[model samples]
Target: MRRIKKTQIAEMLLEHQLITKEQLETAIAQQKTSDKKIGQILVDLGYVEENKFLELLARQLEIPFVDLKSYTLQPDLVKLLPEFYARHFRAIVLKREGDAYLIGMADPQNLLAYDEFERILKAKINTALIREDDLLTILDAMYRRSEEISHFAESLSAELKPSDIDIFSGTQDFSSDDMPVVNLLRSIFEDAVQINASDIHIEPGEKVLRIRLRVDGVLQEQIVEEKAITQALVQRVKLMSGLNIAEKRLPQDGRFSIKVKDKFLDVRVSTMPIQYGESVVMRLLDQSADILRLNQIGMPKEIFEYYSQLLTASYGLLLIVGPTGSGKTTTLYASLNELNKAEDKIITVEDPVEYRLPRINQVQVHSQIGLTFANVLRSVLRQDPDIIMIGELRDQETMEIALRSAMTGHLVLATLHTNDTISSMTRLLDMGAEGYLVASVLRAVIAQRLVRRICMKCITDATLSPPEITWLKSLKHNEYLNVNYKHGTGCTYCHRTGYLGRIGVYELLPMVPELADALRQQDSNKFQLLAEKQPLYRPLVLAGMDLATRGITTVQEIIRMSGEI
Candidate 1:
């Protein structure tokens, strides 16, 4: 048998049927005008799987292959080379062998990377093949550690004193394209993902740049530095979001995607010019994240059944009322999963369509181009949709359209910014909608808010205060009579915040015949009285109190979120 050489690896794989000739040809073609190895190129262009190609390379080179993603490295050995070199070479120090180090390279064919590692460490090294993405992932994770982040941030931030950071125009002296600044931006995102932040806020303060992570519905300050808003960091993020990097005068909206630890997340970025600099807020929308079902959203079992029935109705206008970030969109998507049927024609007009559901038509509302909600909804009606979901009932025109659609044999689902379910009716009337029209077509209203769930890893018996017990009684919920609720005592798994995640506290009000008749009569005062009579109608505060009794959340949240309700 002939020994396979580095140059012949692609040809051998082609001949061995591991890859098609066209795939090999494409990889070879991409090889030119590219610094990547033929093996890395092949794996990148979907011509071959990363692990499989690594196996083929290992077999040809007569060396062991390791999935660096799962491979752990000694931190001491990893520091053998500067991080800049490690990132540039896409190489890592795997382990030490007697008097030598076993170095892993994404492209072992590149002796330059091996030479750099050997020279930097000043040690004899044995090389092996590793996946490009895996090595980079391991390297990034290593640098993104809390201590490393603090040290690196401190190093770059040394020159960023109070007087150095300018507001209107910061020092553009440092080129934004620098490698270290780019890595700093990536490190911030990776750390955000690790901490399960729903959103990342990069704000420029008068003296310090503050980096905050919105976790479990609360924003916690993470990294703060005097020289936080570097021109390079701003330019790097602007480029990623596809916004005009040159034009920092106005606010911009753009989206970009990121892959952290094999999980792909889509970030919705909005940059607003602040006094110090552009305040960048990135909302991480993980497409690969779990699409929770309605039952999983934390509605009381009694209210969930009624809410599900509301979705089953053939024709009615259902409204979800809450403040921003109350998980209203999540509940709407879960309801769509239940209603999206092949036989039913469902269409939605969203300002920014968040999810893609099969068998349903979703159109984005570009108001600047005149594709407003009312206009798109009017167009959707022409599509003969059986169910219509208007992302928001913002204007009187949209409300009128939705109500008319619901009356004409269409199920209209939308969200409204209202304090409670009853207030939604008043908001519609105040928005110039006809009282009788709203009353006739309205079926049900759902109000919700999010509360942090107790971290199971650190859950301990909670001793409720006498005042808290008395407040629970005011909620009129019997579930808390003698229950020994639990609370998180703060643990690493929950970031020492006593809560790992959040769940919804919901209130569902279904339209009964009495309320419907009263609404059609244009008597909202009577309708409110009738709505309060429903046996299943529990206010959001009461539902949160029930969760408090079960140890799912805290009573303090009930007061903080739904005290007014």
Candidate 2:
């Protein structure tokens, strides 16, 4: 393969109009003071897309462009290059042909890197271009945490005492000392954050203590063999969360903030007394991340416009319904972010305020002290609030207050635990809400579910089986059968699971006069029929199928998310 200088690459990009002359000059100026190369500076300054720039460079240099995320290296070959040298050179072994080794590099122009690799391997070398991001991601995955975690576990097992004495007692304070128990806990948390896991489970068995992380809505077990350190690990977590470390007979809950490397997270800790011991579950919430805007929440263009109209309405009740962990809170927060303005006064009453919004008054529900959602909402009404957000409609009193407030000219946005959009109406009515009042104030209902997205790095075309195609035809979804579909084949970037992240599938139901009349009449059959007739009323199953056809997800994900064929 041929190599080009940095100036030649920049000039080529400019000649193709990939970036403007002004952008090239700005990048050149920054390259003088920074250690990053001109191409790296241009990409960092958002002058061009990373993949596009890399593809252009590959074409210019006449070398293959390797996507390291999809490419897997043999364990033996990976051992040939030490991790220190590999990371320092930003390179990896791609393949071996006869006596020559093909290496993937982010910066193929680095002669020093080539010299160092040749000296270490003592073999003929070939070079290809790879994306910087892809190289870094593959590096982290190749060098996993199994070795470090096992080392921590071994150290803790050796240091632990047989007696049930609390090593982290007397004040819940932290020290800079290198305690094995503390190091084990820190590794667990850091791994969870690195994988974007939502929850961590620590369960003690009769012979072993198991650690599991919930990633992409599925639990993956970790490698921890030492059961002797269970108590010490539990005590350390309890101290950090401010829970009673001595009490193990009942359930308790607490929260704490942790900094894993540079990322800050808020972890909600809950403990329950199991037969073996106390089982702990921690829910990790990102505290340092910015709030997602409405447009960024993955809503379809038409639905987003419709939802925006509902938000702008002066007075009505808009309900977002879903099961637990269905991204209800995220959608609500995104909606609130769009409506957060100086002209409107917004107040939210939550059981435990999750994220703190600026310039918005938030209240936490304390039912033990008689300060419940109903009480807080009533107080909010008297304060003349323009918008009120209730975390969840738990009881009849809260639902009644929310209905009255919506009828009295205040835009009310709240969440409910229901399986679908149409069911939310009956859930409210079953909670003792009057039918006529509900029909008068209800504006719209949004039902949502989170489904795993296909890993783009390893995506390939997929064909549905006979049974799968028959099921889709039965549901009147014929358009999907002839379309080109895709799925991930599993790779290191996705933990060899064929999926990397999640996207929301949604269905919206707007309250028209015809449907409202059926709702007021308490006619379930007529209401169901009318709901099916509404243009905006698509079932969650069909919505998910749309995503599947578009290659954003897979057929299995649509079925798994809907729990139906």
Candidate 3:
């Protein structure tokens, strides 16, 4: 393909009328003072759309234009060019033709890069024009050292054979520093940390062992062909967690801490006997990760303000209600972090203390020794505490004591396993707490669920389907029908899933006189009606939909999260 000269780029744009002459003059003036390329300057200065200009340039240069958003490239081929060359030239290795390699470059006019690549790689080069942003996405995603994980897995498969099985002995000690099982496990942990995964699953199958990582609330699997290696891997994990390696008949739970790639991770392990073999799951919590402040979490403005006000109260019960893995504990911790002060004494009683706060006192629940939540909380009340945080409302006794503590002038924050704010009232009533007590000291309820955020690297315009429009209309959300929405096209950056991380969706319900009256009367229907009538009250579905309208999440995610709402 013929190359377009860099000097003629502006002239061609002028001939094609893609940019006004005044705009070109402005970009030229800015180009003199900045190190940026003229094409990038034009795009940055709003003189031309990036993809449109790149497509036209490709046509003029007689090169193919490729969209790498949903494109899959071989990892081996991508590694041919060093990371330094990939970033310096803004290029990616696409594929190999018989004697030449096809290279995608944002600036195909840079003939110097072509010459250097051909000289170093000893092959002819073919050029394809790609968007600069897409090039950046590919560069960051491709260099995550995923091939090293695959190589480690392959080595483990080759090293361990069927004769290595020793399930009866329940122990296979490896004194060698070059053990493949150890290397594979370490590589898997490093990869999981790099990808921000929450859980790792190692399962034994009839033919192979499957390894899966839970990222952004979804599971991504990797298969290991060696079934004999499962026993060794399980033993290693058991040993690290300080569990009995011989007792594989019953389920067991244990925890351990490790440093992977300079990040401290707390792993919770659970083992179960399955049909094939033992299924092991590891939940990873980054101990070194910064705790999110109240404002940093994704709370809407009005709700955040109201909840902040509740935290300032001298004494009341503030409950965070959600199911498992809905981020209830995170919200509770953030609130405590907001209220942590020298003048106020704060204490928490958790079954297993997940995080350690600097000034706040934390108690762990140990039922075997009679140190349950209720027992510990009853004792903590006599210590002249100003603020109290309970990890969970596990029983009726604990529920009643927490309410009494709130009524007796102590700010108590706790979490409940309920669907929404209103159901929490019913739960307390069902737990045998007096309705009057529940009504007197209850300040607010914060219900939350986590939804995956779209990958910003590959976000694009999206149109709502007919069914989605109908659903929104049924909810009286007609304002969203014409709004411009966005979604992510599958990309390597998000593992081809179009979502990178998770964000919280909140439903804040503050107590009012009318709602309290309904609660006291044990009338849940009346309480819900009055709560929904409040100006600041929005259900979980509405909150999630608002995020979808702003392109923070997708409509499908809102629907998926609102199954109970």
Candidate 4:
């Protein structure tokens, strides 16, 4: 496969006179603009039927042609690799022979896949040329093993005591029933991780304990057993996360790790004392979530290119502003990836080091031991780091250290809690940093919020409501008036919510001389005007609206995200 001459498809077509030279030239040109292979491009352009092209290519390459339309595939066989790896390599194990695997691949000519399959499956790979559509069809089936929750949700059938499972009742102890509780907690963790849920909430109510999972950004209610059982489950979770199971009267925080498949996720558990009982919430921090590049965040092309330019600056503080859970951490990591170099030293100090990046020294802040953000920033500066990332510009001391680092030489990246990019400058000033200091070293401010994306599987054409139509007329999108939006009515894939995943709606502001002058002079009114008039500036409201017009999200989400433009 490494020595495969992919030109065999073109040569075969020429030998059969299946396409004219002009048609071949046209198809090749199209291929340059697309990611499809030459055979797929030729078939797509109607130069040859897909089946015939695949068959001819198969014969030319001396590989078995697999028409999955009529082929039966076993889910267990295809699931030999994790869903992430399966989709990344676009190859799945069809069958195993001794130490070799018969792998289904769209293009049997790929040699890079051989090494990947060997590394993942720990075996050799034999090629079977499968239709691209067929390969994707079975990937969904293979991934269903993880995403389908009905399999492990049966753990809710256990019975329990009704009196809230008293921790200090003196006579009651959970040691005897620890095994069943452990199994139940493991089952709940498995179901949550499989569906890629961001957080799991188990709350105690007067009559029952409500268990819910926050998938994407929406919380989905789940069927629960009696209140008595949930009380036991709460104590079980506290025990697993190393919290004080004997103290339900006060709030607590703890963390634990769980392994699902070949990956491990850190679950941050917190319990808040409530009216009926202690309510538990678990936030899953998957390491793989932070490794995404910027384009995956769904930034508009203009905004993406603009932000990419800002990351190239050698010495300045670039801040992404948003509320907690609004994708600021992900944006910060993406920016760090842009600057990550082998020769240049990069160091980050975070309260809780979430994702471990390669070639970067990461420090976790322990405020309990006086190892705060300011303390760590001062120490990281002494390390002679070329670039530094402070997790948050939390207070005046941390801001002072970060600004000095940026003004001296290092490229600093951090996040702050603010509503907009312009507000970020004001926030820095409010944090007790000198106006001149902030104006001199600040590079760019990016404000963002997460909006759930419409599920592609269930999306259907949508008509504007009367209020929605009236609202659209007031926006700056006259050219987009004819645009048609879409929404998911409801589907199981999205847990009955119209949206499946989250994308960021952003507003970015680059520091210009005039804005710096305004900030330096402490003229808040002038600074506001200068910020609003910056060249090519798009506000968060407009960006979210553009996404709505293009059927990416709904208008309701826009109003909910940015509030009436």
Q: Which one is best on TM-score?
A: 3
TM-score of each: 0.71, 0.77, 0.81, 0.71
List, residue by residue over 414-506, the lDDT tens digit for candidate 3. 999999988888988999999888889999998999999999978888878888778778777677777788888877788668887899999
**lDDT per prediction?**
0.78, 0.85, 0.86, 0.78
The deviation in Å at residue 128 for candidate 4 is 40
For model 1, give the RMSD to the true fold. Answer: 13.7
Tell me the TM-score of model 2: 0.77
Off by over 4 Å in 4: 1-164, 167-176, 288-290, 476-481
Error of 2 at 235 (Å): 1.3
- Higher TM-score: candidate 1 or 3? 3
**After best superposition, candidate 3 residue 23: deviation in angstroms?**
18
Which candidate, 2 or 3, has the higher TM-score?
A: 3
Q: For model 2, what is the alpha-carbon lDDT of residue 427?
A: 88
Ranking of all predicted structures according to lDDT, beginning with the best and ending with the worst: 3, 2, 1, 4
Model 1, range 18-88, lDDT digits (tens) per residue?
A: 89887877877878889977876877787777777778778777777876534546666877767788788
> In model 3, which regions exceed 4 Å deviation?
1-57, 60-63, 69-128, 131-144, 166-169
Rank the models by TM-score, top first: 3, 2, 4, 1
lDDT of 4 by residue, 123-217 (tens): 77788877777667667644653333323323332434445354323223577755655665666676677667889998878776677878877
